[model samples]
Target: MTRPPLLEIQDLRTYFYSRAKEAFIRSVDGVSLAIAPGETLGVVGESGSGKSVTALSILGLVGGNPGVITGAVHFAGGNGASGPRNLLADLERYVSLTKHDGRIVAVAKDEPGWRAHVERALARVRGKQIAMIFQNPKSSLNPFVTVGQQISEAVRLHTGVTHASEAKERALGWLERVRMDSPRLRFDQYPDGLSGGMCQRAMIAMALASEPSLLIADEPTTGLDATIQSRIVALLAELKSEFGVTTLLITHDIRVVSRLADTVAVMYGATVMEHGPARDVLAPGVEPKHPYTSALLASLPSTQTNGRRHAVDGRLPVIRGEVVDTMNVPRGCRFHARCDRITDAIRARCMGEEPALATVAAGHRMRCHLHPGEARGG
Candidate 1:
């Protein structure tokens, strides 16, 4: 029997009330993704393109009572697509705690059990099943706590290791696994005591302490020096290979994706315009149908300083008005506002009609009126 996907997310939307704009932000507007076990999926996008929010939404992290998240996020237990291991079915069971006015909203209908379930899921997502190594280790890690304690705390909660001693041992072992020599000494050191690379390694070690099946690393190597960044990404690749773990590598670095991703998903605005095999997504002309993807390929800085660096034209085109509201995202193509293709006559239609995602190739999906397939038939 075939097993279920390691993790599958379908049309996931996460909206947040924007205090600055007084409108809900389409942070994780509509996203669908699937990953096989042991595959590294690279999510590439600009800073505000909703990559991090999508990751947080997956673990139900974004703090909001009425914070609506509508979609499915499923995880498999070393099972292929045919298996019954679906996180969506038991999705609420994996989501973090939700309390409105001190009243628990959903989770088995009971107040206490609901709270317990919420706590458990929070502990699980932040605990075992999924681990997130954030972009900034300094802010994420506590200065007072020893690196070992932080990791040990997670391991102790997620696993059945009752004794603190066992948790510490496991945590130290993880530190060693991340290739931190003399882990025992480093484990007792505070976050501030370690160098940037060591701190990053400690963070990774902490994140993996629970042996999570899925690791969501958000720009894990950003902010670090080039040499350190290279080492960090290498460390993660090694871990992924050795443990047979699935990873969601979130970054805007095309080069990083080239190095680590087995599959690359390009995020433009709140939608995924194009995606496919890692190499295919990076391929020139014949492959990428979206102008955005083509632009991204073109925008990549060339190795040799062939004249002054030139960025994509037109200031990244900030949608020329206000960011679209999640509550009222325009009908057709979400990218049409900033899109240069749609003509004046049909621009209204492109802005008004909703375009569902369609496959142009065997495993590739794109939602655009520009596809030749749509032009030929209809």
Candidate 2:
């Protein structure tokens, strides 16, 4: 049986005003995704494809004028809650918009009022119910405090281990759990004392110390050495198996997604192009895939050999054309400008109107005119 989604995002839109451009940068435009209980959903895309922005929007962390204009992030609490709570409840009351030719031209937002409401709504939920591990471990960590103390603070705050001695013990236990070498020595060390890999391990330990029901790992393996990245991935794999914590992993690395995610969402031009089970969506030479997904998979440096992947000889295939610009997204398919598979039959439709995310196969969805007959709402 299919389980109810633990985190459901419906038509989320996050925009940032650019004074020089005299317009809003649609960082995350009309994105919808869901993660079931104990499932890890990996969102993969290019650098400017809005992967990180979607993660930030989910936690209500987007900043700037008129941010998060519309959306619903429904999170099902793990503490015996009756149903999923809409984190963006009553959002329309604080913002007004002016539309010109069916496009947003101006926005008036009560920033102060909205901020206060968000804080109130997420007071008991942000760190306790959902924890996030940001990309930069050193920058995210407190520079002035010892790593162990920082983790102990989180343990005390969320896990009810109030006593200093007990909290410290629990913090040490987490350090050991993350496989930190010389746990005692590392406990007293500050952020600067640890290597990039070790700091990442510490960050992971701190995030899991709270035992949050949902973990959002945004580019967790980024900015690390290749060897360190593999180790971090391995550790995360182990932790996922041990804890069974539901996760939303955002990254540009297909390898990381292949290793960690049970399901995948491919984002482009600030929107999802395809979403489905990892095995099907990431499979090489797979049919019925969106042009964007096929291009991404084709760009990989490895090829299948004897049922295993190995490095190839020649230069990797490159997807022609630049990534879509979000400031002025195209009217039709977001990837139409760069798509290589547009046929004569679908050319007009692919250029005239945006295609909805339609079912192409069981448990698989794609947004392209090629699958017009299966059109359905995202």
Candidate 3:
């Protein structure tokens, strides 16, 4: 049998509840994704399209108290485990059996015994098995501490390098691996002391210091110049190959996804609009099945006139009306309000039934009403 994917997310729903429980902001709604070992999956979308939330949900980092997450995220390669299983599986059984980086761990958004499970899971995997490089190095890095100290801490913690000298040495080695110049000297400098590119490199060093199996890079090139962005992208590509790591790259830059991703998932209005191989779905000549995906590609500068850009008409619909209730989400199609292709007759039908993601071709799927006989409306 073919091995299960390294990670599998099924119908994930993450909603934020108001204090009185009177309202819900459905940040992530029915998002499903899967990634094989050593493969890269790129999630592309505009801001507030639930891309970050999806990543955070996977890591069990979505906030709590007011936030409630309900979903199944199955991860493989945990300790002696042979295949993937839900992280939210029976708490007691999961903790006793699922080991990651030499520790039994269970991480969930919210559940009984969730705190203990999440803390242990994070301690073992956050820096060791699953590393994350955030969008902003400044926010991620501690301004008061020297860069070397931070990197060394993670190296020592995850690798059991008890001696400070050895930890610093490992940190320096990681810095060099990320192609940061003069690694040893840069180690002692604080976050404020390094340039944007250098600081980002330092962040990468810290994240990679533990030799993680999976890396979550959330817009790692967000603030860098085009030149620096290209360098970072190249560096990530190199590291991914060297480490044989599975990567979940979240970004708004279609160019970056096209260049680095093996698979691309286009998300909008808190839902995935299209998913397929990066090369085939993002090819210049091919028209995407989903209107949102097409509009997004058309809006890119390279696809525009002169230096001007193409803009999608109207605005992204307020998902499920403006009520923010999961039960009250728009009557039929959530994206129909902004979809320019909706006809008067089709609009009436679409407004009554939500379209499920249907296969458009081999290895390609899209969520849209105009998919002809493949309509999954109910």
Please name the candidate that would achieve the greatest TM-score relative to the true structure: 2
The TM-score ranking, best first, is 2, 3, 1
In candidate 3, which residue ranges exceed 4 Å CA deviation? 1-3, 18-21, 90-113, 303-328, 372-378
Off by over 4 Å in 1: 1-3, 20-22, 78-117, 120-125, 163-166, 283-287, 304-331, 341-349, 372-378
- Over 229-333, each residue of candidate 3 has an lDDT whose tens digit, in order, gives 999999988987788688999999988898789889998767787887786577655665577777677666564343223444643432222322342456677
lDDT of each: 0.71, 0.87, 0.75
Give the per-residue lDDT digits (tens) of candidate 2, residues 292-370.
8877876766545323222257667677899998998888999988898998888888998999987776667888887
lDDT of 1 by residue, 45-126 (tens): 7777788888887775666533434567776643244553434344344345355654223322223443444456454455
TM-score each candidate.
0.79, 0.94, 0.83
lDDT of 3: 0.75
Q: Residue 356: error of model 2 in Å? A: 0.3
- Model 3 TM-score relative to the real fold: 0.83
What pairs collide in candidate 2? none
